[model samples]
Target: MRYSKATDYALHTMMFLAAATPRTTIGVQQLAERQHVSPTYLSKILTKLVKAGMIESTTGVNGGYRLKRDWENISFLDIIHAIEGSASLFDCSLDHGPECLIQRVVTAAEEKMETYLREQKLADLAKELNLMH
Candidate 1:
């Protein structure tokens, strides 16, 4: 039911990228400093995001990370899946048939949450943040 700090960091990092809507790259050290986290630790998480195609990593002295897609198309679920994977949060270890009522209930709940997240675009929130600042 709970997501890891990695997911938390990824969501925040994504929000930052979406809000800034920067064309230039943002250094990992700068991102880490802003979050008060270790650059090394954040790099690992960023790698997952890169693999997910949500962001790109640039190389060289001015190299860093930047959003690869339009922020308006990015959803909360996308960033969450990049860090948490799309695997079902609840898996019944016991050998239960497809008729398992508990499994059905949990699956329905998960689907509802997923739908909400999928529809909630990060760009909308970022725009609101911009207004606040």
Candidate 2:
């Protein structure tokens, strides 16, 4: 399955947060502008993140949202799970609906892909993105 724009926006937003000062709140408006995403949609994405305990939000002057935990500890799979839920590609067996012989091959391939993604940490992505030198 393809990733939704929500996931892209979430990862971009999280990368910025990871690079920013810790414990410092970042306004949604500014974050949206920086990430080149609409504030309305970004707000929804941020809400999901906050609910997942990945971020903390505060209202009032000099307040916005901040990461609840260290970026190094956050994984790409964690973000994917938070936004997309525990969804899987090969959720069904081909043989369950039809007499297909590709079920095992499809399942094995899907598992390998999932494992690779699960091993990829958000920190790894951030480092890749920050590579300018």
Candidate 3:
């Protein structure tokens, strides 16, 4: 299973925010430059994050974006869900068929991955990356 490009950007963006000073707001253009992503694309991702309640945004001269919750409160799964809606790695579309062996295996793997991601917080990831002080 693979995550979408938007999911990758969301994860990176969240990590960047987590590494920044608490309550610090960053402009999309600046963040895009630092992350080597297009501002237009990043802006769309940021909007999804805001709508998901994962990040907050403002307008005007001092306007920018900031994490809505502490990094410790955010998880990889949270970011995944915010961007991809669901973290299920399997598309199990065989509801009518008799039991599919592959479906069982995929479901188990998806569950395991979901558990792992839920246990991993953004703060812990930042610390591992040495982005936390």
Candidate 4:
């Protein structure tokens, strides 16, 4: 299942933060430039992440954003849910009837997808990409 562009940016932002020096704060503009996303759009995404307690934000000369928790503690599903709210791979409308077999299958698939995401941590991703030092 394809996630929204905002979710994609959020993932990239988190990974970038995770790969950087621990506790090093980065501005949204810098993050946007690195991710090739619009600063305005990235700012909104960062807001949601901050609200979710995934990232911390500060204002002032040395203020910016940083990961609020350890990379090992943050999972793909966490980032997904933080941005998308409920990581449902498929939207099943009950209009097809309450007992639709297809709905059951889709729900099962979504569960599996979520489980896989939950097992994937940001650290793992960084290591896979050789971004971790």
Q: Rate the local accuracy (lDDT) of all candidates.
A: 0.89, 0.79, 0.84, 0.85
Tell me how far the alpha carbon of residue 88 in candidate 1 is from the true structure, in angstroms, after superposition.
0.9
lDDT of 2 at 97: 45
Name the regions of candidate 2 deviating beyond 4 angstroms: 91-100, 127-133
Error of 1 at 20 (Å): 1.8
Give the per-residue lDDT digits (tens) of candidate 1, residues 1-133.
8999999999999888877764658999989998999999999999998998888999999999998856578899999998998999888778495688888889899999999999988888888899999
**lDDT tens digits, residue span 28-106, model 3:** 8888998899999999999999998889998988888998755578889999998998845666676643377888777
- What are the clash counts of all predictions, listed in order? 0, 0, 0, 0
lDDT: which is higher, 2 or 3?
Answer: 3
Judging by TM-score against the true structure, name the best candidate. Answer: 1
Winner on TM-score between 1 and 4 is 1
lDDT of 3: 0.84
Error of 4 at 5 (Å): 0.7
**Cα lDDT over the full model 1:** 0.89
- Scored against the true structure, residue 91 in model 3 reaches a CA lDDT of 65
Number of the candidate with higher lDDT, 3 or 4: 4
Model 2 C-alpha lDDT versus the unseen true structure? 0.79
Over 4 Å off, model 4: 94-98, 131-133
